[model samples]
Target: MRPIVVLLTVLSTLIFPGRAEAATTFGPREAGVNAWPYHDGGQLPKKYTGVVDNQGVRMFVHPGITGGRKMNHPVAQAQYGLALVNNYRRTHDSWYLDLAQRQARRLADTHVDARGAWYFPYRFDFPLSSGIGLTMRAPWYSAMAQGQATSLFIRLAKATGSAEWRRAADRAFRSLQLGYAAGVPWATHRDAAGRLWLEEYPGPNPATSARVLNGHIFAIYGVWDYWNVTRSPAAAAIFSEATRTVYTYLLRGFRNPSWASSYSLRGDVPSEKYHNIHVNQLLHLHALSGQPVFAAMAEILHGDFTMARVTATIRFSGGTHVGVAFRSTTDGRVRARRGLTLGRASSAPVDQRRRIGGQPGFWYHVTKGALAGFWVQEFPGRRSTTGPIATFPYLTRRTAVLAKGSHLVYRASGPSVARVSATSEAGIVRLGWVDGRRAVLVSAGSLRGLWLVVTPRTTFRIAEGDDHDEVICGVSCERVAPLG
Candidate 1:
């Protein structure tokens, strides 16, 4: 009990008890507030914990589709590796050390070397539900796995001085530096704001990725781990830039004063399991960086551990309207009955959020329905005193009735949001939405992936080429002019 309290205090202060060595007390935090300990499956001869021998190597297993039984998991194996390394650090156990090596050997043995940078592939079908680049086939890999594997490799290299581990780390760390623009992109996503984010699930395109918070943070730890070991200037620069990116979107898009934090930029409130992980991860960052805001956010999130029951409210300041987007504000946290234009208020502020759905929809305070007192998605953005609200206008230029097996092009009449898109043919490509400045480059426009047309919907134009399938509907909710 005494040791636990002492450990917590030291971790909170970001003070490593043994600072004489390079980075011995550092990896991902496996104790205190932010513990990411992957359970070391019990004694081996006949028994194991959450682990299964996949072919020959020991891999962590989860009850995915196979209820109660275990299936091989990507993150789980990496996490277990980390846990083994952590155990080695704590108890100085040679067995833990050997297990860590075996764990990493599988990763080193089977990593896909794209050019020089390496990626560990997930070879099974996983459900993907984000914007763009999704065909019938699931995307190959994830940035989270990339980051986790990198961290494990770095730690193994530093601990055992294995040249193999160092080489593996070298390849895996380069994966972090690759951008989303590559022919076979790694994980780094350059946002509309020109900031780089390590995406957890970078669907098929960066247009509407699952800009997940925990995944980015986890990746940040890996980057920082690499930097901590090598002291490379480029690694240090990436670490700084990525941390800044997290700060940029933290409050603006991720936080909700009323509800739980968003899992990604696009996802709604997360489940209890993920929500707890989020809280702990934030605290871990706060401890590592000595940042006050991260700690503050952690404190706030701790209080929000339980769900609050919401009953109907009789009066709301904003009048009732369906499909109107109302971005919540600091000042507008309360309800006033003066009746503003359904979310347009002088007191409350609004922020223009990013989405591919092509219209601003936000958390508007609902008052007069069965779901009253809930912050509905259709409350604000009608008249945003803040920024450009999303508009989904059914755009119509000169529509060409191409033949059943013909491709046509239609230039947008004005600045508009592309609402829906369909394949011109069964396996042919759809017309690219070009707006002079930026074009949404998609890999596949399959019906399975609605190619969820995300925002940053620039002004005026579509159909650069003559390759066309069927009718692509644009809910043109802006001033659009026909281009010849």
Candidate 2:
């Protein structure tokens, strides 16, 4: 009888679309095969309006509604920027490229606060003279926003050969560092085992201080992108540290047969809602670091997905989006293991709390449906490695070696001819790698965007070659040519 009733209820809802309260309605033309509506398919209310800047950049306009508020989170902007850039590269379409450039410029110039920080604004209908107000005013910054923006600027710099884009990225990175350095201190808690847990606010405010797994991944992305651009040691230090921190606190929470949405800074599970963003971020981190730990973490998310029961299906672009209701691996309730309380104290007002943790909770209402397109369009299954190893065959046969301090050293066990080259904005030129003791310079002039290569001698070390006296006369060789 119960099974029959459940079947009839589902059949009735499918038969009469209006019976599905959460279903989003799309216009005849706007609706694609698999497209789902955003937050019940409603526009911004009469009072809350969006701002369009002079650069044709739209600000404060958001898709979806949670707590009667428009969800204008900054992560989407960065993701869209990347999607546009990817499209431009694929089609060589000037329009896509132009839009990407404009978007990057707008975020860097218009959205940035006077302190060189980027703020997420809820509403921005101020007069032209002043600026965006009523932001989540705190020292803490969104790594999700800044990280993606940093990558956009780096890509722009490479595409345009512009130093300004690189500088813009530098400032954004500095702002993230400021957030970590100056944000409010964490509130600590101890479990039954007496291990203390530190919890910092997750970017929005103190009330939502419980750490989230997906949020920290964006910060890692930001630092990694910056490190790749400048090869900055400072950025590398931060990136490595943050990577371990995520590994320790958030990633470890996956030890359960299911994944959690929120965890204590000490890695205790508070909310066990499995999220698609976890899979997305893990895949991203794996691509960036080429580490096995991230791959292992992603596999856990996949394992949990296997247990989900598909409740409904919606057609979206290019594929079908299935809505799955998760089944818990540990009975049905979200129980805190090891005798620790699940809930945390909050400073957020009643309204903010209600909005931040709405019916389906803030993360779900905002991202659940939206993430389908994001994962499908913006994030693909695999990406090229971002490590120092060059993927292009034209650059060299071997790509593992990198420069250190005043010298780059490579050595070969056998005597063989070696050729090394670097191509930058300056031009294509050879690089100084040791044939013997000979110090080689690709070109006499300054080399910008320098990349090096070597062959035959599997191992060799090359120095600045600027010191002729240090050059081994008979044993050492140097090649310097004027840029033609």
Candidate 3:
């Protein structure tokens, strides 16, 4: 029933556009106070007459009441606060910052338990039995909600010079860390015998295993943030182990070795799935860990893009449009193209995969000024057993590419030949030297809108080679010459 309700809400959100604006009708004043009150599942009154219930809680019911009232769960509140903070960051809006702080304060005061732990009940109506209710207090739920709360608190503390919020965040972090197993920090929940459990709500049936990797990843992010704030080695160690476990176990098993179809713990991989966000997160993790394999996997996942069959509205031709088909494959067909201004056109149908030297070569399109060109390279396969291809500049203003054997280097700054000699970090791709002046590197696979960090002193020159191959940077190259 709960899952069904969640699905319905998600479906409604997908079907009806502009629902968020309609839902937030009060614009932060509907709850009768400056802060928004938590709503249990039910319709809110159309009119905000500033009414208070018997328990002194504000009436937060939305319009369109239905079975199961909406209450302010700690996790939801935390997410709300995070969203507000994000908005504030973008707009520098004081109203959003104030609202976010108010909610953060409320969560800190109400959710932190007497045992210095943090937990929230399943709903406002649920009794605070056994310290917290199962629905809200579940390890997975708490980690997510409390993790956001912690992040918000830390951000607030930094912004407002508030030690109280910082303290609350620290307490929350401690509570979550203590809840996990000693060494296996990746596991979210634990059994009574103190054994690590991967799935948050593991049911008796194998099919009901609720082991989604998102929650664990969120928890790790929270821990990593905490470590950044305090520089605690303990926190850093926990974060590292959690990352290692996720990449080594969860991610590896989720995708097919052939890099086709979406990987899932519950059987067949779905087509046209958008787990690219997850893949992106893993890429960041790989960067932090410097692991080559994880880097390679990220490249494969992104480069060999798959599409799921989903219907969505896309804006094109500089006008509001609708009814666009979205697929999971990297080379899926686009139903329509919109938003083209003059020579500026959408490159949605570009085929990145190509064949070179008995191997599958992939080409990425680059456009600068009125000029557009194609960058061609080979895909990394197990049999190749080489490093990245060659380091060059991606046409994108801030991106640089490197090739080390069969591995590809995508950095924000230019890569130094000296730095490439170091051992690759865990879960990242390692580049090997093909020669003194040239090296081969594999692609990090399908990434978009991500920045690569490179060295500041390196210089590049554009030189045209055979088969339309353009070299942008070399060991002693100084000038970048454009190829016509």
Candidate 4:
């Protein structure tokens, strides 16, 4: 039997539609087809409204949420099931599938079969300033919930051949039909443009709409799911109409000029997270309809031109001694495993890292340690490292050190990185390490600003580099000279 819930009151003192702000509706963070991953899942015990049931689910009625006592959010629950189902899809794990089935059963059982529409409703009242409304009453439903539930049910039915899931899907589609007015509450919203939008919030007045972008897209996914699996003519109509609305008004209605996509038709900007969602949804829409416009916008919105990149290494002059700096395999400057240091037990060099932005001067990858990855110059404070980086000590009498640095390029900031800054002479410089006493400077000029070490020494021999891994030339290699 379905739950005996009714449509909440409208145009009351406590409830009305919203205009400016946009808050997150309880649903999937990312937009895509079925089997898409869920960003979050089932709530922790602390969120429970203290009402427990045999189904092990409770209403999450936190204070400051609304004026009503408590209520279970069908939208949230349906998304949770989606997460579990996708988890099962990725891992072939039966546990997640079983849990998803149970969730679908709950949704089917509690559906409000009233006014000739099988609507799944929100039991609690919406808080003041909610993007959907300022003071929404209890038992309100949304096209998003109905669509997601419809998607959820039909998916399970098709995959598992369950009769109950299909029946629930059929009934849920019925609610998605009528506009959110009169006895039929919350589903469709026909905009002023005459484009029929599956509204996220068709608040107290059915004529008004939140016209939320992500919500509309998510609901379309459900309708798309229905049409794709069952090929019902009605489902096809809904899918066609909803996507048509998106394709037609996507830029004019939802885009905010050169900024992030609008949260609603109200010219409100979305956060970075939601912007990513927008990009994904647009790309997915392009795939679904082969629309060039969505793909072009997605590419533009997902700008990667400002990424950082490192090309090569720089060299410094050490008078008598050079401090060993380790570029650990764990440093953000370490882009990838550039092959291991042969025969060495605990030290290797890496070339890439992330989040090294706003850091000036040259950045050297640190050695392996417990701390999170951070950028460094040729020298840094004492830390742990199994491999050597480029930092050093034994500064000039005045203590002014110079080094090379790099800039950002396209790609993930933290995925991996390259070398930082430069040298003028041979485009390279190597300051050899002495026995904690002497330093070797390659064609080193003015070692102490006015001091010069002669190349015509009685005896000069090529030796191991400061990293103790390879041998370099002892005399002037002709390609390097100190900046002096």
Off by over 4 Å in 3: 1-68, 112-115, 124-140, 180-209, 257-274, 287-293, 308-484
RMSD of candidate 4 to true structure, Å:
21.3
lDDT of 1 by residue, 1-484 (tens): 1223433432332222122112222222123322232322333332233555743345543455334554445576777778777777766778777777777887777677786898876655555443323332233667788888888899899898989898888898899888876468478878898878988777667875778788888888777677767876777777766766665566556665434567777555444335556666665554454443344344334333322222222222344433232233322333323223444322232222222122222233444443333333322123222211221111112122212322222233323333334223222112222221112223333322222222221111111122211112212123222110
lDDT of each: 0.50, 0.38, 0.38, 0.47
At residue 349, give the lDDT of candidate 4. Answer: 34
Candidate 1 residue 478 Cα shift, in angstroms, is 40
Q: Is candidate 3 or candidate 4 better by lDDT?
A: 4
Q: Judging by lDDT against the true structure, name the best candidate.
A: 1
Weakest ten-residue segment in model 2 by summed lDDT: 346-355
lDDT of 3 by residue, 336-384 (tens): 3222242332222222222111212222222222112332222222011
**Every model's TM-score:** 0.52, 0.44, 0.47, 0.53
Rank candidates, lDDT, best first. 1, 4, 3, 2
> What CA root-mean-square deviation does each model show from the true structure?
22.9, 24.8, 18.1, 21.3
265-335: candidate 4 lDDT, tens digit per residue: 64354433366577667656654544333443443343211112333232222222122233442232443
Over 4 Å off, model 2: 1-73, 111-140, 179-208, 259-274, 306-484
Native-to-model Cα distance after best TM-score fit, residue 275 in candidate 2, in Å: 2.8
